[model samples]
Target: MPSFLQVAVLLAVVITAAKGAGALSKRLGQPAVFGELLAGILLGPTLLDVLHWPVFTDPPYLERLTRDLAELGVIFLMFLAGLETDLEEMRKVGAAAFFGAVGGVALPFLAGTALGLAFGFPLYESIFIGTILTATSVSITAQTLLELGRLRSREGTTILGSAVIDDVMGIVILSVVVALHQAGLAGAGDAAGGAAAVAAGSSGSTAAAQGADAGGAGALAVGLIVLRMVAFFAAAIAAGRWLLPPILRRAARWPGTEPQFAMALVAGLLLAVAAEELGGVAAITGSYMAGVMLTLVPDVKRAVEERLAVLAYGFFVPIFFVNIGLETDLLDAVAASGPAFLVLILLAAALGKIVGSGSGVRPFGFTWMEALRVGIGMVSRGEVALIVAGIGLQEGVISQAVFSVMVVMTLFTTLITPILLRWSFGRAPGSPSGAAAFSPAPGPRSGEAD
Candidate 1:
């Protein structure tokens, strides 16, 4: 545990940094996340250590403390993400969003996995690498639509709906990959023991036979992991619908309205933790579901969003990005990936999202040009992609080289989104819904940027 003074100083740093960076980003016409990421990089090993900050070198606890606070940022982020989801709207554009999200996740993941596998990555690593490519930060695209005042239009609805699916599907893919990776690691451990038994055996035949058994066991382990994940998700879905509502309703009637937010936060985190404990995918799944449920209720949703935004912008988010910067070994990540690999990753990242999302919505009767614009609109990746990549790197499923490649991919995609939205929509003829224009992408009607 950190000392009281240490915690206080760390909190102070996060608030100052986030606010400063956010203001700068807004001024530069960039998304606040860009500034946050930049702030993190500046405070991290790359810059602070390079400049020889005494605090970084002398106190190990400071770094860890920063990380802990930043993690809270991630949680708050997910809470907000959940709050943004609208199930009724999602239902309206279900087909387009479903296909768009599926295609978007599928292609990039496959491309990434294939690249990793071709480079001699193990199966689990390849799968994880691919999983990193799954999420679309629809927030970026939504922002563009908002600037253009097209957010409430059909295309806007389709994009938002698809983005939600994108998040859910991305989490599912990540979970499946994690399950497989865990199984593989366990199997490898078991195989090591089997190999030792063979080495001590009397004959070569016995060694070969043992190796075969180990392989079979590895396959079985993988199967069991998949089964476990399926069971966990099924239980969660049932519980969310059948059990959570009444509990939330009861909590809503309690003494303080603040408890409603508390209940939702507690429920979201618990659900996430439960999912992870059960070998299911992203912990944020529970958070997202909680958001969906809270929105369904008439009175509680506002309080929940209010509390989440306050906590998010106030402290947690800045700390998270700053810690991300501190932990980043940028040179190592870049050196491992190399220029050629980086280029390939970038191309695949852009093409995968554009092609997948663009094609998916066409059957919904959107004009081909509108579909292309939507695809371009959705192409930029953001926080979700970074989170996914961070998970893969932390799990040791991807080397620093692959992780670096992902960072570059994220940077390029995010940086280009505003420009693309501006250029594409600016040329279109004016429409009442503002779907026809591109320069001023839509902003959220909720007026809650936090």
Candidate 2:
């Protein structure tokens, strides 16, 4: 465990650097997140290692503490995002959102898989790499749009809705890919055991029986995973509709906002834990669902959002963005993967999202410029990408070098997304028409940026 003093000092440095960098970024007309990310890189191995700094190098405990805090940051950030989402807006753009999400996921996945294969990676590795490319982090884009005062516009809502759908699709794909990989491993083990038993002429029947059992188990596991996911969403939605609103309403009457905030936070955390523990879904997804559930309660949504934003944006969220940079070693990653590989992967990531998502929204009556704006908005892959990459690294599916390359790719995409989105919005035909055009029946805090 890290001592209190060590943790405190580490946080102090992190917060100071993050805020300073963020301020600098704002001065440069960029989102504060960019500066925070850059601050993390400067304080991390990329720069600190050269300077022999101990902030990230000499203390394992500090690193762990930072990671834990960062995870909390992401949970709160996602929860806030969910709270801010306009379900009515999403409904209006449902067709466009669905197609955009599908195209965004499919094209990137296929392109990434093909690239991985071209690089001579194993089948599983290739698939995992492809999976990484499917994630879309819209928070950055949302912030940029908010800065440009276009977040409530039609294109903005479309991007937000599509990004939400994109996340759902990405999680489902990840679950399926992971399950399939496990099944493959089990089959390989069974095959090896069966082969060995047959060579020794020692009870091939037992090996065959075990292989059958293993196969059955794998199938059962996959089935259960799918079922769990369905059950989790069903339960969350049901609770949101029937249980949570009343509870929040009651909590809203409790003298001050603290009670309501506490109730919301507890509910969000509980659902998040349950989602991961019982449903085997990502905790962020659970938290996001919880936020969405609360959004249905028009009376208390703004209070909850206002209360939570102070804690989230003030501290935890910045840490999450910065932590992404701290964990990545850009130079080492590029050196190991080769500049060509990095450049190719980066290009693939960017174009796959822009073209795929852009093409998906064209049939929805959006002009080419509007579709391009939506596509550009979905190009930033932040927390979700990092989480997926981290899982892959932990499971030994992707090497450290690949993980580093992914980190750099994520950072690059995140940094450039705001600039690209701003440009796209500028070139987009027509002025910002506010939220009324997209969602006439605004849910609680619906038009706020994620």
Which candidate achieves the best lDDT against the true structure? 2
Off by over 4 Å in 2: 49-58, 146-154, 182-201, 253-257, 425-450
Which ranges in model 1 have alpha carbons more than 4 Å from their true place? 50-52, 56-58, 118-122, 202-216, 427-450
lDDT of 2 by residue, 260-299 (tens): 7899899888888987788767677788888887778877
Candidates in order have lDDT scores of: 0.71, 0.78
Model 1: C-alpha RMSD to truth?
A: 3.6
Model 2: worst 10 consecutive residues (lDDT sum): 441-450
Q: What is the TM-score of each candidate against the true structure?
A: 0.88, 0.86
Clash statistics: count for each candidate: 16, 0
lDDT of 1 by residue, 1-450 (tens): 346665676567666776688678767877777777677777666666422344334366665666666655666677677777778878998788888888888888898888778877777777777777776887767766766777776877888888888888887777777767777788788778777886777377877787788889889877877787777777766776677777777887889656666787788788778767764566665566666666666466776676777767666766776566666667776777666667777787888877878898888898887777677767777778777777787678877667666766776887787787677667445555444455444322111253
Q: Indicate which candidate wins on TM-score.
A: 1
